[model samples]
Target chain A: MPMPQVPFDDRGLAYGDGVFETVLLRAGVPVLWDYHYARLLLGCQRLNIPLPSREQLVATWQSPPNAELEILKLILTRGSGGRGYATPDNSQPRLLSRRTPFVVNADRWHEGVNIRICQLRLGHQPLLAGIKHLNRLENVLARQEWNDPAIAEGLLGDADGWLVEATSMNVFWQQAGALFTPPLSQCGVAGTLRAALLDHGVVQEAAIALTAIHQVDRLWVANSVQGVWPVNKLLSETGVVLQSWNPAGHDRLQVVGHELLGYSPTSR
Target chain B: MPMPQVPFDDRGLAYGDGVFETVLLRAGVPVLWDYHYARLLLGCQRLNIPLPSREQLVATWQSPPNAELEILKLILTRGSGGRGYATPDNSQPRLLSRRTPFVVNADRWHEGVNIRICQLRLGHQPLLAGIKHLNRLENVLARQEWNDPAIAEGLLGDADGWLVEATSMNVFWQQAGALFTPPLSQCGVAGTLRAALLDHGVVQEAAIALTAIHQVDRLWVANSVQGVWPVNKLLSETGVVLQSWNPAGHDRLQVVGHELLGYSPTSR
Candidate 1:
């Protein structure tokens, strides 16, 4: 909030050496604050980046509460100077938070959006599997696989043909009447909303193979900032529809998103 | 030299969505500039980030030429503004250059260093392999495996036990009088010096198994900054020497490094 202590040579910029959290704020209150805060803390701890007190993070916002939703980003870096990869014995962690306007299409909540499978497969690294660290070039590359405005998201899998998650959100699929999400032990960011859902027993972890993608009947993508969106279709690179799902069967799942994000079908 | 156009929310800072080059500058001239430039261009091209003109990059140095050697780091990032992973249509590239005094242990050039195998193994991602992108948490975690000043570098291998490289340098080993280094088509940074060596036909690529670590009588680690360091001994986690190499047989290999870096055994 104050002039960031992160210098030009900060490791975060140099080597992607940090963790970040994106919180959706509504009327100065963070939606799913407990889940987001817990993940932020876990990420910092996993990376050995000493975290500042909760008061320090909370104090970053000085603007008056806006009635509308806004995006708040928190970045905690290991700070500068360790001669390449070595952590400085006396390293001082840097904490930075920025608030920006939030924008979303309310229709997507009910109308759903089409998604695709990405060509780029995520490599396995259990040490960094679940933490939302800054090394997200894989996600960036997967997201860049398509620029078509109609295609809202892309599904990513590991090298072993196991589904991981969507480009910017955790993915859940329904075949019978239960919900299943990919396990993040091998790779992928452990989204806060996904964690909250698992904790509440709303979903179960399962390994979905690439060959079985079309077998599932219903699918949805979600994140803390975007809430939830039912995936209406899955398209191939050549624009052929590979799979489709009906929103009628998945409308009940949307209720969980509304309760978690404090959103309704009419709210943006 | 001008003020950085990168904002607090730049993609590079947010996701490490960029490439970097660390050049050893000797008397204002960049050592191995061509190889470094080529990799930089390849990285930007691979990520679809437009690169500026070569002359513009060269112009970032405003200080008078110094006779002493220094480290020059150039970072080029996909400039801000993209909906999560969707790149902005007219995204501008940001280039930043910083110079810091270079320091090295000259004795390591001749006396060599002791090394160890890292506990962490690199994940296979051919798409991002060997490009020197900023998603380098693997290297950071590998380097953190040890704090012993005696262990100059950590050797890294893939999940299948095939040797990849070291934390900060490309690795080379001599087997039966022929030089062999790991192929980085799956992962690891394809360093400028390593490319130069391969270009000059000074070395050949081979799949060195982790079990063959002790079988190779000679090993060396190299990069542009420190030139090269021979492995005098290989230590296990318990501080026991797993293998030892005689510098007398590998002094010829060090010559290749000295020639490429424009350094003499006597020079710093």
Candidate 2:
């Protein structure tokens, strides 16, 4: 299929003036549709962009190519506006969706993935924190920190050295059988899967420091697209192993992922 | 003219992964073309997007639009990419430009305009600071703080309460016959006009606090679109007058504007 073309005046392109969702499609069905949609609405409200009807989104997701496993990206922009930053009273919201083939490797999922810490520190802005807004240059720079395919992701922290999240996933650590994740009120995105884990009472949000990652018994990173992946090794920028863990807790997370995201380890 | 359409996969919409410039066109010619193009190139370099050739940009800006006074917005995005924050190896850059009619009121230029302080504070991101990139949600939110036409602009400060810039213009204050503007190294855009003023040795960049704004003898806001507007009164969020200045320095700034921006109050 051909890619969609966006207007030059799109406020999204002009000012990163929009929000987005990346949903995993399994067997032609979108997973965690409710959570994604709810987050989208919240983002719209935060930016004061008019919300599109729910039916419009559902219809777009329902009528799609029958791909077995794909990544469905939905971008909601404040349409087009004038040259300045002021929101026009007559401005309308726009929805753009596209699908791309994707496959999660079973080996990486089973034997956890390696991660490295990023040098780029995210600045604190509560007004823009926790929402999947389009102003993501920080994430882009963090993700570009490593070129080695062995490093699955890069961990990011706030300017004050508080552990936030991975480049695109939420970070969670298990210490004494209690799952703890960082509070994203100051920085970092609030992932849909992270919220689901919290709602299911499997994870607790707390203020975590970068140094605390070494004391954790187990670590995992998660997103809606890949569900969850255990962290086998965490490395610093100098390539020194900060921490390493066994995959003993992988099975428990697999069960939790199945219950929360309707994901199956064997599906891949 | 109608608005331009953008593609769904455009990186500018995806992650504000682009650079932009707003140039003022007088009698169908782009004002301060050299400075705007230089800044655009610098922004593209900072974001790692391939720079568009100068010939391509000049040709676009030089095209006759037949407008008396207009605002020409030029956006250059990293074309399309896969669904991720990482830049694609084979990504192509896209250029989009549109012209819209705009005119500065004579009263605003001659009698000075009222200004207000915004509640939304700008975050410090030295990596993305000073460059007029596509991530402008902060400015968008700040501009929406007040709809009162009497308030010509909103003054924004960094998270540390240091004055940065207005919602769209660079801020300058004259104290004891010396022009002082906020340093944009930590936050705020380094506007083209601001650079021009500095190059002329008429303005000095300093770390000025929000409270220091009241002590200044005179104030002015500047951008390429609108040459310069003197601030007659500065108001707090509760409509209380924070600082009021006479028009003593307005004529001096007008001469500076005429020399630097080729702007004449009588031309409009």
In terms of DockQ, the best-performing candidate is: 2
> How many Å off is the CA of A238 in candidate 2?
1.9
Query: Taking the tens digit of each residue's C-alpha lDDT, what string does model 2 give over B52-130?
Result: 8878887765767766887888899888888888878888998888877787666777777899999999987898898
Instruction: DockQ each candidate and list the results.
Output: 0.60, 0.74
Deviation of model 2 at A221, angstroms: 1.1
Q: Estimate each model's TM-score.
A: 0.96, 0.95
Candidate 2 regions with alpha-carbon error over 4 angstroms? A249-251, A265-268, B1-3, B248-250, B265-268
In the predicted model 2, the residue pairs found to clash are A5-B6, A5-B7, A6-B5, A6-B6, A6-B7, A7-B4, A7-B5, A7-B6, A8-B4, A8-B5
Candidate 1 error regions (>4 Å): A1-6, A265-268, B1-6, B265-268
Taking the tens digit of each residue's C-alpha lDDT, what string does model 1 give over B99-209?
A: 777766778886889999988999999989999898888998888889989789999999889999999999999888899889999999999999999988889999989
lDDT value, candidate 1, whole model: 0.84
